[model samples]
Target: MTRPLRLHYAPDNASLCVRLALEELGLAYDSVLVDRRAKAQKSSAYLAMNPNGLIPVLEIPQGPMFETGAILLWLSDTYGGLMPAPDDPARAHAVQWLFWLANTLHPTARMLFYPDQYCDGDAEGLRRTTRQRLSHQLGLLEQASHADWIDADGASAQGCYLGPLLRWFALYGGATDWFALQRWPRLLAFAERAELQSAARKAASAEGLGPKPFSAPIHCHPPEGSAV
Candidate 1:
């Protein structure tokens, strides 16, 4: 029997990261979709699990894990094939990319995507700036995507975990025209494979998380070398 994991996530939020990981790992999981719009995450039930009331809390075989990065890491540690061995240098590379997504790229993209949180007035200007900044990161991601798994020529294994995040980036940054990523058929193919394997799709045909309107203030600033 497959041991099921419990994942608490908003239908639209940071929870997508963990959900994507679970899907990529091919693990059976029961997802509790917390409606952040209704403040369901702040309810007494969820609060008992995560005092911070964050989305993407994972209840693994070991215990509850809050925060998107932690949940992903836990899955990597607990499940084989999702991550490289702990002693492998590639494992460090995976962790580095994970943190880069969490601490830098994700936060930057959030700010650009949701300028309503930063300023009350006309957000169009902020959006343009954010888009420009996002483009630079996407460009970096495109170069990074040239690695083993993404590059059709290479036989190396890599995290296909960046798929959803890149999809979101393309959606927001208007970056579907990126030549580098487009040239990498392997990466696109990998994303499609992972998306098809997602639990949300199998269970209810849900598309996992979609882009939500954000109003949370960005706690982090745009990284240097960002076009914005």
Candidate 2:
């Protein structure tokens, strides 16, 4: 029998991209909320699943998987959809964007969102510097936005990863004003179009997130029990 898939997640975390990917693939899975306020993610049991103590730990039939990019890649490679063919020339480009999102953009956004975690002194300074770096990165993305999606293809995990980050920039990084969408018209258009995607909408709705997902008020204490 095919064992049920299980996802250990916390609200408003990076795990969201994994959920969006699963929804896009039309895959059924269970969601186990890891209470951040309660430190459930740091518990021994959770750590056993993901020693990194991350919010997203996908338990597949064979074993558990950690890291947002790795899980997304596994799902795409295993499920045979939402990614370019392994041998396709565009596959390299797609993979490059995915890595860039995971490594460069996501980490920089984290510095902006949780400055204190990254630095002990001058948190605001760290945020300002990170925000500036993020702006440069966004400008690069805007310049590269000649395509409808980050990938040459229609929609992939890359778009799923980027849309939320853009929203986060508006909510946490003061980008809504200083780095307004008007400054990056192409990225704004891409985000708007990505938000309308069925999978994106469904995933956000499932997480109790609103249309302006990152703008939504995060619940420190979510409802008790599994959200599946």
Question: Highest TM-score among the candidates is held by which one?
Answer: 2
Count of clashes, each model = 0, 0
Q: What TM-score would you give candidate 2 relative to the actual structure?
A: 0.88
For residue 42, model 2's alpha carbon misses the true position, in angstroms, by 0.9
Instruction: Tell me model 1's lDDT, rounded to 2 decimals.
Output: 0.57
lDDT for each residue of candidate 2 in 136-160, tens digit (9 for 90 to 100): 9988988873333553335587877
lDDT value for candidate 2?
Answer: 0.75
Q: Which stretches of candidate 1 lie over 4 Å from their true place?
A: 1-4, 120-122, 145-149, 152-161, 170-193, 196-204, 208-228
Clashing pairs in 2: none
TM-score of 1: 0.69
Across residues 1-228, which tens digit of lDDT does each residue of candidate 1 receive? 545798776543566556656766777788776766578778998888889876668887666778677677777777766656799776777677677777777777777666787879867777777766766775676668424444433111233335545555555543334323444444555454544443434321343233221111111111111111
Would you list the clashing residue pairs of candidate 1? Answer: none
